[model samples]
Target chain A: MATMTQSGKPADAIGLAPAAPIELDGITHNYGSRLALDKLSFRVREAEIFGLLGPNGSGKTTLFRILSTLMIPTGGAARIQGFDAGREPNRVRQRIGIVFQSRSVDVKLTAAENLKHQGHLYGLRGAHLQQRIAEVLERVGLLDRADDRVESLSGGQQRRVELAKGLIHAPSVLLLDEPSTGLDPGARRDLWQYLRTLRDQQGVTVLVTTHLMEEAEHCDRVAILSKGKLVALGSPAELKAKIGGDVVTFEAAGPEQAAQLAAEIRNRFGAAGTVLGSTVRVERDRGHRFLTEVVEAFPRRVESVSVARPSLEDVFIDCTGHRFWTEDAQPDPAGGKNKRGEY
Target chain B: MATVAAAAPQAKTASSPGIWTPAYSLWLREIVRFYRQKARVAGVIATPLLFWIVLGSGFAYSFHSSSGSGSYLAYFFPGSVVMIVLFTAIFSMMSLISDRNEGFLLSVLAAPVNRSAIVLGKVLGGATLAAIQGVIFLAFAPLVGDHPGAGAVLLSILAIVLISFELTALGFAIAWPMDSPQAFHAIVNLLLLPLWMLSGALFPADRASGWLAWLMRLNPLSYGVDALRNALFPAEHTLFPLDVNLGITAAFCVLVFAASWAIVNRRTHKPAA
Candidate 1:
């Protein structure tokens, strides 16, 4: 595999391993008085499927904007292939492909037309541009539908066109912001499969920002964020293994009862329970036996009990000391969209 | 399926692409989008034609121009052409708001293209459509009992093209900061409509009294209408000489285009919304 370096020097020659395709060096961003990203730093290894996992206000959207060169950070810098995303935005733009959370493909144009226009922006033209467009469409499995108007295509097909548009210029790094937001389960599975193929076959470094835990589980490594801070960073399995045992969850009547139950568990078995809303969670090696002992000690007090292997959500709770979905993350009963960047 | 390139391009950081190619691509997109919507093409032409016919006929008896010999319908022909230009040139930029809302603008902004190119491409696209519509309306000059020589026809085309460019650039400036088409519509009613009405489009500047006359004299579009009126009707008395009107109209075109370019580039200096 060939390693891409910004300085044009081989990675081994510079006494460094394979150069990171994307890097955020103490990046900070604030919307007016509200801080969206707080001196956050991370590096995505070359050709890896990296997931930026966070709840709505965890600053993933802001980070995505910075990486795509749509917005300059307030402080520090983001580098794609070692080019500054803020100061040298056009260069950064050339090296990275971006898929926005919202639909970016023009519905009025045919899929090929959209890709042709996108290619023109990156200075691709003539027969070379057409060949590139056809190649990208084929990679996304949309070659036959290239002549179809994007509006006529299914939502999944339209998204594939967007992916084709991003890939037309042959970018080294592909950045997707919630690529599977509107996708059905089957479409989403296809999207992940395609992303994996891009990484495995073309060596495109794929970085996806998603709020879905299941989506993060598919990433090779994930960066979990909370309140604009990096709380955990590792593969999902590694992060879960950090908890080192089974996850025992207990549901009580209310927050007060959950906190009381957590305190009792700490005092009785010397196991600390994390209280989240009306539930208490404790990590134990022999969770089956521990569940039996706890349930017998307080038969009627505990409403529900379950023991299972630690999932990514458990890792999140273990790191952040809260539930994955806060009250604000819940869907509004009145049908208002959840506000992002409020935390 | 053909394979993607095995390796990254590994090209050094290159400067942003020049203005013309991306501007042309964006321009092509606007034209394709406009013509694809058959209703937009019909509405832009039909609404003004309807307005000109009904309004010109109704006011034929009630209003009279300073040029006493020509009928009100004949006198309104140049103004009607300007109306077509204004509608096609100005309202076409309403696409910017929709583009932003639909995430199309986001993709363009993220592309490695110059900001000035964006303003140029959009303004030129609107101007092309507006100019074409205005020229089409000019072909109906014979219906109004006016016959122009070849020189007059060529000059009128020039005047229409300039007017189209100016109005489209002005629209780009107004629509750049606006996120909603409703706000742009409000601006059209408040500023653009008043600008046209007071530009001696409805009545000649010579007939208007006092401050109304001053407002007409101060209006840049008044010069455009004056220039077009001179071209289409060589016998009619124009508010300003053809040369002076074209000069001022040309200057305003440059001014508005520059203003739009500045507004767009200024957003880049700040955090993009």
Candidate 2:
């Protein structure tokens, strides 16, 4: 027997099973003359903690906007909870909870007050609203501090309260933009632990956006965007494994020397190495053996060499032919310097 | 892609609550937030009182004219109430920009509630505050020696609510697409203050010559001022009958509200999460 929905069937019309928790089919968006999202396509599965990974100008935010139905894409279609994001935003809005990159919690309001307003927005009231508020507050470990105004709480605690605010409506899917952005190490770990618990206990699907590679490691899967294009997609390990084996890098004294080392590696070892600034980079099956051979071949021409398993950054480099722009290199809290030189 | 059966959501229940819940909740928040801010309470009340005292006295001493013994304070008393209404109403609307900038509006926008509910909640909240301020300012009508009779008093309260709703909806229309409070302030001052000043609030619309009288006739707010003036000073000269004043001013309220509804219902220009 097939299931039936109130809006009629994609369910009973065919044995197509359930719709994806979120599906972006060639979603494209533009901001006047500049393109924001360029025909990007991906789907997030049920109970999955999906990450949209990208740096500044990479269009992760644009994709986030489309999925949340805050903005309609200029081209293509996106669906959330089986309803078109553009055509049926109110229906899509009902099924998802969104936590924005900026603070949405009112400083003057207590944790319970924030959740109370949120519950009302979702049509919950009176005893039902109070119980759900307490449930989500306890879920985020903030029940003891529910009476404190949000301004009185520490940054991490306030963030937890924000998470509580998002869950007050019992939304099936939670959409977060840069969830761990302002948190310290302990807070980030606790946040992800709570997210994983939500997935395991309640079968909730989570989609978050982040520029941090280490942050991407926590996600069940990641779709990497670069300059409005989907550059890569897979689980962290899967993307690394797609790099074949290890990544080999050799440092030369200058750009000219780096290009020379890359050409030499291509000719001698048949590895199509790329020159990134003053280093020659290669992805090979056995990077250690190649590293030794390349060092031995060039002797003193190569100043140093290293071979290591690939990270998401390496995967980005492999797909986009450029180094991943990381905040680790730039400490500014403001998303700064789109054209900064990369080594 | 064809092989992936993404987990469709559980079917939606058809019994979503009426839009009234969210609208009322949002309205309650505005009131709660307002009373909580001690400075805002002081400012809304103080500014109009000061405006009435200083401007009314100064203009009386300097620019005396015949409309009655016309203690300019008496003349400015009605305008002063309108000022209180204007300040409180526009002040509430200005919070829209700050909410957007500070990210509070994002959470409300993401909710399952209807867009009209949002407009209704916000506008009603602002109108309530503005109307309260207008009534408070009316308490000073005794000082100016223009205490209204019971019938006129009832009509005066109605006029205040209509004007507050009209101005707040006008503020909402102007402030909705604006991202910065400073920009909104600039647009409102340049556009709104002039509308108030020319709306027979500062000077008589009928006696003014050249383009000013013509401009006042064109101003919807002038009709509001005219209606309020008649309500407070019934024995004084009126440009139009009481019924005419109420009709045109009520018509202005509907026009601004419908325009505001159209602005909010359109998919907002703000980006998503």
Candidate 3:
């Protein structure tokens, strides 16, 4: 059995060598005057599935672009398998494969042709190229549809072809940006199964970016980013464990009144309270014990109250002071500015 | 069983070698793409024929003098052939823009292949398409005009290949940062029309005014036209010596190819979007 960590999950069974598959050191990227990534540093171990969990404009794509060598960082360094991403990009490229958020496969070509072309780009040809194309197609569960033009296939099928194209060259590391964007629930589950198989069977390190908490839960380790900075990094359970208690939440008349009530409750219970929008969330070890104090603190202010066991979403709300779904729906230019104008 | 188990991991590791393999593979794929598109093949064939038939007939009766040994068709046919190569070469830059917009360029860039190989492969693929188009157009030369001898035919093909290679390189050099395919097409049309006209693809360069003649002399396409004429109709009235035309055109091709290669190499390293 693999050694389990404090997060109550087994560490990677194969135990990749200390040589990092991807390493970013103080990487900073900017788009014009706005900073996209600020001194971001992380490492992905071999064969491990690393998730970049962030809201839109949190610079997750920018970080992925830097790792894939599509864009150079403005400051610091990024390396893949010890090859400098900027100075020796071709060396880095040779070691890794990337699937962009957009559909990369040519829709005009057959699935097989697209894979063959990708194989050719990697210098696979003759029998070897054919074999690899067939193998990747099979891996993605698109082998039977290899002869069909990509435009004729469903969106999920086309995405699978894109995955096959990326795998045709047998890259050591694969970077995918929102691979499950348009996939149906069933197809998304199927894709996840395929990804796990690739990791288990071939030991290919996978890095994926998604805003979905459920998708983030599937990763071996998750890095939560907000406003171009990493706020939390750990396994899903470990992140939830960071929260002190079951989350007790309620809507108030307004965030200003909510803040006042939250402060009074915190003064009595000595627990941290967060106000997002019109709702106030309090974290306490004993939810029943805090419920009485919370209501007694502000009887007229609290509109409704409910206590629930902490989830990854609650952990995100706790750390970032905002709900994931609400933040995802509204693009926060100021990075989750609450209704009371607090960031 | 033990030996086989030990060999399995080694075999998997050896399956992928980090080098020129992917680049070469992509080059081959581009060649395959060129051959697979029927519409592309038709366009390549039709464009040159339109030049040979429409442009050749429009200018047939307008000969200033029969000072050359041959008739108008013989004199103009070689120039049209070079024009064919130029048109085919320049128009192919649209494919580059298409590839970039389709995210195919990014896919190739992300691959482990050498960047130079991608540029060279595209150049070579465009040149090959141009060469095929030139060959088909040359075969129809007899029906449209006086046919060149066997040696001239072979040499004309060689000239067309060389000229196409240079023009394709020039197109890529210009197309690198073009935002869209339409923009590239506009630029190519604006540049190629005047270039062909000034290069004496339709008329003799000597007949142009002093400044226009100077511009024609500077135009690289002129050397290609002169070389084609020299190779096809060697006995025609010579504006410049045959050796001078061939030498200048060959040198220009080398210079253009090198310039395009350097530009593409630099652009590939830069962030496109």
Candidate 4:
């Protein structure tokens, strides 16, 4: 396990300098026989939008809960702003603000009242607390809706209220567990804009966990996790670059036909082709040239073909051997509509 | 860029330790919550008042001969106050269960606040609410029957506060480990109903059966009831042979409070299962 400074920059990074606000060290947690986080280690840099990208059941929420001091690790340690999460949780909590995956805002109370109550929990009160509440509500672009009950707000607006509640105390580090899980595209964009502003303007370290590939792209750095292990960690470009080349994908009739097409393409291009369900993916320096050859070689078998730059979605599929939107047990994407919401 | 310049420096100062911040703030919030929930406030006041009016009248004839010095309502007024304190304290503990389920408790735990502060703040807040209800019930005692001396009234109020604190602590300790609100309420019903019955609240300890007398002697609620009765009706002899039932009740209050505080603080600070 590696350690980092309060800025979340790796202490061991040569020229980069240490800048992280949170660090995890060899964290391994288990519930009975089932392992949740297996030797997980990562750093969230200060004033940077860091994303913990993982599919559901990949221990993202577990890590978030531990970092937020809701739970302790079964083994290893987590540090927030130089305070140990396990041994000095109050110190860590004092420095960090958290928004859980679930909507934690009090539905019975108005948005402003919820923020005021949360502010009080952290000892903010009177005019200072009221000012902070107004400031954060404005930051989330929900200042006008502050007097509205949370239950009366739309799902997206309610999420914004939750964000405002988390930021009411102006924590040094903010932990958001899938903050935009149920938002529409416009709402999500607005949220991302607010997060960016929070990072750039306030110098507040923002750590978020999301399965949304496009959302993960907004992060300054991302840690792609699978089965509780961080399989890839880097900037979005660096992670996509790990695929080595542009991704050429084509679909066939079935898995058997896809495998045969991949084999034929491998034989013709002398490059490795991987079969995922009825789709075959081949990576090459020049995706167009490879696609032309594959199309010419298996014209009848190749039902559809597309060539594109590698994305976080493709990177996730490449590393985990599963599509980002596809869930366990069902190969058909439509069978798991709600599962996508888990990200 | 201009906004960033203004907000960044303030962010650095946000995490500074303010030791009293969490407690005082949470305490004030609980009080505000109680005030806003009008139905709950009315319920807290009405429970003991109902017992005083209905039960005091129903037992009025019996207490005329047995109680000796005063009317039945007079004899039962202090007991009613104790009962009110007990009822309010136990019910208020259910808020812990509510807060935990609603994720408010988790939010508080995740904050920089001290665990002991959370426990003490909750206990004191609940006691304060219960004290208010007890005081309201005390005010109605004169209307229902006999009025105690001013010193006795003050002493009865103090005893009610102490009883409320003890019961609130006990309720917290019981409710802390409970997973669901239903389970917590069930436990409260199970523990409180029997404890209240055997406390001599409805009857004098001397009139109780031999087995019942032994149970009353050991019941903590009995001490509270006995102390309040002694303060209210100064003419009646002590419920027990010893003249130190108040001392015993005070000890019981302290013991219950310490135990409750320890249990709640430890439970809240422990890593969530």
Candidate 5:
């Protein structure tokens, strides 16, 4: 039996310089006629918490499926640590821990039992397996409930056990989909805290997919996807910083009034102003000064005005020409035919 | 620090715990999961007993074959044992569908284990469960007045194991691509149960009219049913010779198992298709 030996340990595991944990080179996929991912390219550096951000039809789920070795890509390649994910899936699977968006733990089995079975799948056994199970349970703060059935545990606790099951193998890269889906705010925070700890302490690379912008904020870097294309990719702060200056919006009484005010602001201040329904939005460098200048210029034409820093949501809107969430344009490209993970 | 560094690489990647480890683990899981579900255990025992009593006794007084050595109840004994094996096998394979729906199958698929290990684990587990139930129903043989001695019992047990393996493999084949338990049941009732019915279990193959007799002769399950009959009634060599029946049953096990393995080890992981 060929077993993993000690020589393969990277320098990063010993707190040395990190290696590129994951690299996706022009990964493309199609669900029949719908192209889920379009020439997607990105690289996640070592010990980094990376997020794949998208909406229901934006293809994050498809990308997650490919990277987790659940689905092979229609085109291009995904490599985990140096091994190709599609071609050498078993080797990729050995180095990665996957936490699916949906519940994967056996509710009927005890926490210890679930971990035991998972350990066996990874070829861990005997007293060594038991010790690893205990360690992972303790790390998840569920050692006390090790013997209890998963059905007896709370939703948050069950999610933690799912994490424990993944961590039992202690792979270098952890991929999760919608990790905060069922978790309450407190549990969500705890989950992020654990992810950060794993990155800092164990140098484990974390890659996650999320639809929520706030959730993406916790990641070290985010790849904003829209309609199967990489719209934006950078740290949350850097992406926000890249948008530049501030966003100023003026709420007028009506669309006509807002349009009239936008025209005046465009001519007077030479700031690009667009009427967005009943509000006129302007992007400027010195937003506060521009807000006062615009308000004084318009007088009673502007009912109220506000200026704020750019958010990840603003970056998403700026890149995609839409809000983070849209009510009318429900572009479910898969046609809800596949029930696995749309949103 | 050197020792920790040496151990750190082990954490980076998983080891292969020999060829059979994953199969053993999955097999153990099936057994553990089966024992934990009290309803499944009750269902396993009660359904066979009920079928044997209700169906066996219903035909006991009414059924008068033109030529037979014993009562209909005795005639139905071996068939009832095969029924027990079938029901347990059905129950075991049904979990495969449920497992796929509930996300456990996804986890297993992502594991570093080989696909053949998965097939071996699940098939062997279901076969073991069905075999146990079949043997338990064998204890009721004395009540039906067909209690053969030690050699007969040993041969009958072999036939039961062969039949159990073949049926469980057949169940795995049926349940492989199915997504829903309802669909699996519908197909089993429509196709699988009919296979057993025409297998000379309910009625003798020799008595069937022309084409129907040929169908019984062709049905692989008939070989299993006929093998059991030969072992139970060593004196009555009607369907086929004992050695011939056992050989065919063994061959049936391999055929169905190969069919199952082919389906499971097929490349893509699309469960619905």
Candidate 6:
């Protein structure tokens, strides 16, 4: 596991022999006047399925581009297998395979043809290239459909072809940007299963960026970002454990009603509860007992109340002081500009 | 299926991709993609053929050439060939905009390939297609009653290759910085269409007035059109000798290709997409 110090420096060099597979040492990026990444730093160990969880404008897309060597940062550095991404992009490109959020495969070509082209780009040639193409197609469980044109494949199968194209070069690190954007439920499950197989069997380190909490739950470790800063970094269970208590919610008719109830509860019990829209949430130990006393104290004022264990979303709220999907965080339909108003 | 014993990828000294492999692969992709679209092939060839017939006959009676070529169709034959080359070369480079929009170019940009190879592959691919289309138009030389010897035919083919290379490079330079096809179409119509119309393709430079004649002389494509005229109609009077015309066209090809290479290699603060 990788650790971070209080000063936001990676503690991986504390008697470790080999460097981590992917490391961001104070990687900062600015799109014009807007700062997209604010001195973010972390380390990803080898063969681990790491996730970058953030909403739009959290700078994960900018960081993804930097890691894939598509964009250079304004400040700091991203290193892949110890090669700086900005200075020696070709070196970084050779060690990493990138699966973009958009479709990158040539739809006119068949699956095998796409892989062959990708193989040639990485210096593979002749009979060896053909064998590797077949091997990768088989690894993605698409060998039978290798001859079919990508235009004819279903969306899930086309995504698998993209995975095969990335794997044909045998890169040590696989970087995926929103790998499950349009996948169906079953296909999404299958995609995660294949990722686990790749990590456990081939020892390929995978770094994925996603906004879905359920997707982040499937990762071995996740780094959560909000407003271009690292808020929490750990396994799902470990980060959820940091909440230290159960979460209790009181739902009212409207924001005004919820605000009134939140003020009364804070005054009477000397507890702090956050009012978000039409709900007031409080985190406390023995949440069931606290729930009963609060409901009894203000009958019908709290229209509904519930107590549950702390989830990853609660950890996000605890760190960021806001919900994961705020009203203003909706993605722009015009493209290029993210939720943070950065292009 | 349960085996988890795959060998780890060994770390080797990273080698930047040389020109040949990536260029060849990209070039091969262009060829495959072009052949797959049957309507594109038909339209690229047929549209120019239609214009050659309609415009050649439409202007035949109303105009008489100062060059003493018997009919307007013969005078317009090489011009139509040039038109075919122009349309194919410029239109083929439009794929670059689509490639970028569809995210295919992003994959290529992320690969360990050289930037110059990208320009080379794409330009050469379009040039090859354009040259082939121009030659296919050349096969109709007999219909215009212009019969040249084997040497002249070979020279005409060489002129078409140079013309296609230069035009495709020019189009590549224009298309690299643009994102939308609509903007590219606007630039093509405003800039390139006039360059072709004044290149002695439709009218001989000697017959034109002072300023239009000067414009023809200043255009690099004028030299190419003159070279084709010299090759296809050996007996007809030409503006310049064959050697001088080809030399200028070749120089333009190198210059435009270098401009495209520089554009691709430029490191900007903005995203490459």
In candidate 4, what are the lDDT values of residues B32-143, reduced to their tens digit? 6787789888887877777788888988875663645657776677677777788778877887777765666777777777677777788788888888888777777667
- TM-score value, chain A, candidate 4: 0.87
- Predictions in order: chain A TM-score: 0.90, 0.92, 0.88, 0.87, 0.90, 0.90
Candidate 1 iRMSD in angstroms: 6.3
lDDT of 1 by residue, A11-51 (tens): 43244444468888899987667677799988989899999
lDDT string for model 5 (A198-235, tens) is 99999899999998989999999999998889999999
- Write model 2 residue lDDT over B103-125, tens digit each, in one string: 78878887877888888889889
Against the correct fold, how does model 2 do in TM-score?
A: 0.93
Docking class of 3: acceptable
Relative to the true structure, how large is the alpha-carbon lDDT of every model? 0.85, 0.82, 0.74, 0.76, 0.83, 0.87
Model 4 whole-model lDDT (C-alpha atoms): 0.76
lDDT (tens digit, per residue) of candidate 3 on A1-343: 1233565322321232234777878888776577878998888787999999988877786787788887778888887766678876766776687887766787767899888778776667789888988888888878899898888999888888888888877888899988888899999999889889889998989999998989999999999988788888988889987886788987788988888877877787787788887778887788876787778877898898899888878877877888776665434333233111111
Candidate 4 lDDT by residue in tens digits, A185-227 = 8888888898888888888889999978888999999998877
| Model 3 ranges off by over 4 Å | A1-17, A322-343, B1-24, B59-66, B69-76, B267-273
Per lDDT, the best of the predicted structures is 6
Q: TM-score of candidate 3 restricted to chain B?
A: 0.85
Candidate 2, residue B122: the lDDT equals 90
How does residue A241 of candidate 1 score in lDDT? 91
**Model 5 over residues B96-177: C-alpha lDDT tens digits?**
8878777788888888888878888999999999999899888888887776889988998999999989998899999978
Residues B106-164 of candidate 1: C-alpha lDDT, one tens digit per residue: 88888999899999999999999999999998778888888889999999999999999
Evaluated on the second chain alone, the candidates' TM-scores are 0.93, 0.92, 0.85, 0.85, 0.91, 0.95
DockQ scores for all predicted structures:
0.39, 0.43, 0.33, 0.29, 0.48, 0.40
Report the error of model 5 at residue B186, Å: 1.8
Query: How far off is residue A46 in model 5, in Å?
Result: 0.5
Between the candidate structures 4 and 6, which one is better when assessed by lDDT? 6
Worst 10 residues of 1 chain A by lDDT: A334-343
lDDT per residue (tens digit) for residues B96-118 in model 6 = 99888888888898899999989
Q: List the residue pairs that clash in candidate 4.
A: A7-A19, A7-A20, A7-A21, A8-A19, A8-A20, A8-A21, A9-A19, A9-A20
Question: How displaced is residue A223 in candidate 2, in Å?
Answer: 0.9
Q: Which lDDT value does model 1 have at A323? A: 81
